[model samples]
Target: MKLIIGGAFQGKKEYAKQQFSLQEDQMRDGKEADFEELFRVPCLYHFHEWIQKGLKLGWDFDGITERLLQENPELILISNELGYGVVPMEAFDRTYRETTGRICTKIAAESQMVIRVVCGMGMVIKNA
Candidate 1:
């Protein structure tokens, strides 16, 4: 199984579904279904918690990596890429941007392929 991890609104997830012929409203099928179910259940709290944990204690990042290999599932996890750019001036903005970078790092590390979608265009980052 293979997966993509990038950023929010990067078309990562969309491309995955399209590649699999998955309907917009339809759930995933095949061996990957269980992994996909992670997004189906309501996020316990602020969805951002997942990202923060990744940067702070590597909880989110490590967890995702374990799941990917354990399930050997095809995946596409989107994130907001915020590094290699400006430093956020506000606290909340800084948190969001920082966490985005951490999560992206984790996801890309496990990705067999990676792409950076900017201005609606996806630039392949690895093994395109």
Candidate 2:
């Protein structure tokens, strides 16, 4: 599976479509959650931790890995790259950035393709 990754607000999806037809496989951002409201953010950071929690509840991070063998997915994944910025002050802010960083790293490593979009340009970060 190809994992296209990039920084915040960069059009990662616009690039992911250059090679493969795009499909949204996101298990996130479809609904508003409580934890997100508590943090006053329904942002990537909150979703990062929330997703891991859901994964334990039977969501398939690994199943996507296995599905690659049976299906060729033009999976267009949009990830907010949070590692390249300044440190946050609030406790929640720090936690969110850290969690997102870890999640992105893990997924990027396993992807067949990786790309970094900067200034509306897409640069390939990985390939199978």
Candidate 3:
């Protein structure tokens, strides 16, 4: 799996497409995709939003990383970098940010490549 992260609207999806030669239709939007879709899609964008939705729905995500790596080793995930700015006052927002961060960290550690996009440029931070 590959992980692409950046600030909002930083072109992470586009970079993923160009880098991997992926078609736009092949990528799923996490906002609308069901949980099962994550294991089937070739690429997923807005991953943090999906986590937020799951949290709102009180969905259990235990062992998600293991499942993804096992079920979809070729998946590419694009998430906006969270927990970088001021902490949110809302309890849910804070939890969402922290959850996304922890999940992303776990994924990145196991990913074949981890890239950070800024101003439409991708910088590889990890290759394993």
Candidate 4:
């Protein structure tokens, strides 16, 4: 599995496409995809949003991780870095940020490669 992360609109998706030679159909937009679709797609964008949805639906992180690992062990995940900005004023936003960070940490630990993309450039943070 490969994990790609950066700020919003930071070219994470483009970097994944170029690096992986992925076709348009191989990548799923998390904002629009259902959980089932997310599992089926090789690459998933907006991964943080999917986490938020899972939280809203009362799905625990362990369940989400287990399902994802079972379905797509070779997945490429793209998520924005949500913890760097000013702390959110709303409780939900704060929770979302924290949850995303924690989940990303777990994913990174398990991933074969982790890349941080900024301004269209990708820096490999981990390789296993």
On TM-score, the leading prediction is: 3
Worst 10 residues of 1 by lDDT: 41-50
Could you tally the backbone clashes for each prediction?
3, 1, 0, 0
Model 1 gets an lDDT of 0.50
Q: Residues 1-128, candidate 2, lDDT per residue (tens digit)?
A: 45555665666555554545433433234124433231232122234445445444544344433353244344334566666668888776676577657655665766666777776687887877
TM-score of the candidate numbered 4?
Answer: 0.93
Candidate 1 per-residue lDDT, tens place, 34-65, comes to 33454442211122334554445433444766
Against the true structure, what is each candidate's TM-score? 0.53, 0.58, 0.98, 0.93
For lDDT, the strongest prediction is 3
Whole-model lDDT per candidate: 0.50, 0.51, 0.94, 0.89
- Residue runs of model 4 more than 4 Å from their true location after superposition: none
Superposition error at 109 for model 4 (Å): 0.2
What's the alpha carbon RMSD for model 1? 6.7
Question: Model 3, range 35-64, lDDT digits (tens) per residue?
Answer: 889999999999999999999998888899
